[model samples]
Target: MSPTTVAVRAGFRRGAIELRNTFTNAQDLWGYLFPTLILVVTIFFMRGSTVPGTDFSLGARTLPSALGMGLAFGGLIALAQQLVVEREDGTLLRAKATPNGMLGYLVGKLTLMSTTALASMLIQLVPSLFLVDGLRLTSAGAWLTLLWVAVLGLVATLPLGAVIGSLIESARNLGLVMLPMMGLIALSGIFYPINGYPGWLQAVAQVFPIYWLGLGMRSALLPDALAAVELGGSWRHLETLGVLGSWAVLGLVLAPVVLRRMARRESGSRVAARRERAMRQVF
Candidate 1:
């Protein structure tokens, strides 16, 4: 087999192994479930509440939005966190040292994260079905839309996560990534309508993938009549594709350049220095 094929197979195996490992570990399992549990509670409280100007349960609307947000969070924050922690602990250096290792490593990471994201979404979505009403998952068209939006959403966000991971020098600085993402989530219409926000804020939210992800999810899971509540009175399927596609292109272009620079700078001394600094900070 070709080296690329071999590397990809290795990556798939690596991702599978890591995914299995998460199930076996107590902390990993807890991490996976905690957010889900919180979301469940949030949805429960929202059952009585309706979207502004509509009878649809706000929580039901939130379910798909949250699922989309989960994709964004997984592709961006989770990957960035893993990269920072791994880089600090010298895992990245080891990958850099091996033949075709970086390719394998990246593939493994993307696979693991994508699967994890999907699993997390399902975990919440299935339980949520019992709690929320009016989801349109019964139709083939709805499911198809869900599938494409999710896959495209992953493609749009993961590379951007890689870029963030590559640029950040330390795990301790993850707050910088986390804080902005939280802000984006608020503006992205996860819990409410973007129409409620100022025009400038609405435009800002549109620039990121989170809003489009939420919009796509709503398009899939909500009824056609609900489209009246969205900004354009339609799902704007083409716009979702265009915005997310542009991000995918941008991320694909930048990830390699940034990741290479970050990897090239990794060395024994740098690792030790970072460890020492981390220790100093801990004390």
Candidate 2:
């Protein structure tokens, strides 16, 4: 087959496999549903109040931040943990032996993870439009901003997940990897305004992508008057795109390299020995 044809066929097959895997996993269902529900409830009941430091209603600012958070947790952390466990179990190694196998496997994972993230965003949006009082989305600009930020946020975070998955040894060790990421999320102002954080904490938050993502989404979703509110020492929108784009570039370069290295380490005999040792310890 021509290389083009081969690549096209591989992508299609990988997508189908990913769809099947996503549907079969109840955990994916919960990952999409729970954050969406929380977003809906928070927007519906809390729209009237201001989001502290901003003139927009709490509902207006909260939705985008919540959606960003959902994407981070659902796409990055969840997918990374799954990849680590699957790699430890020899599933990734088995897949790698097939035609275009590694590409297909990654395609499936990305499709499933992105779908869940997008679904979670939409679920929150639906309730925010009709049920949430004082929630305004008057400008087409706001919608445009929301879409851009969400897509960029996913792009920036997913590859980092891939890299993390490649580095970790087991599911139990995921906590060590995840705790730092969770801290990033909190520092990014996903649940609250960053202004409340001390100067040093704000400086620390600037080092990660999540804070920039939240800032960008807020810039896109919040009213123009409220855009002046600083996050991590700059106007929310000004620094967001630049920071996120940089992270996306970095992750794209690093993730595949990390995954390839991890794959080399998990050759058949190595996995078998590890499993045998694990079994012996357990029994």
Top model number, lDDT: 1
Query: Any residue pairs clashing in model 2, and if so which?
Result: none
Error of 1 at 96 (Å): 0.6
Tens digit of per-residue lDDT, candidate 1, span 1-283: 9988998899999999998998789998888898899999999998999988899899999999999999999998899889989999999999999888888999999999999898888888888899988899889999999999999999999999999998888988999989999999999999998888899999999999999999999999999988999998999999999999999999999988988889999999999999999999989
**How many residue pairs of model 1 clash at the backbone?**
0
**Candidate no. 1 TM-score:** 0.98
Give candidate 1's whole-model lDDT: 0.93
Worst 10 residues of 2 by lDDT: 227-236
Clashes of each: 0, 0
Please give, for residues 1-283, the per-residue lDDT of candidate 2 as tens digits: 7754675567667767776777678996676567667777777676677767655677667776776777777667877987987887998998778766777678777877777678777876776666544433788887887888888888988998998888887777888977887788878877678887889998998878777777776676665566556653445564677888888899999988988788767788877876887788789
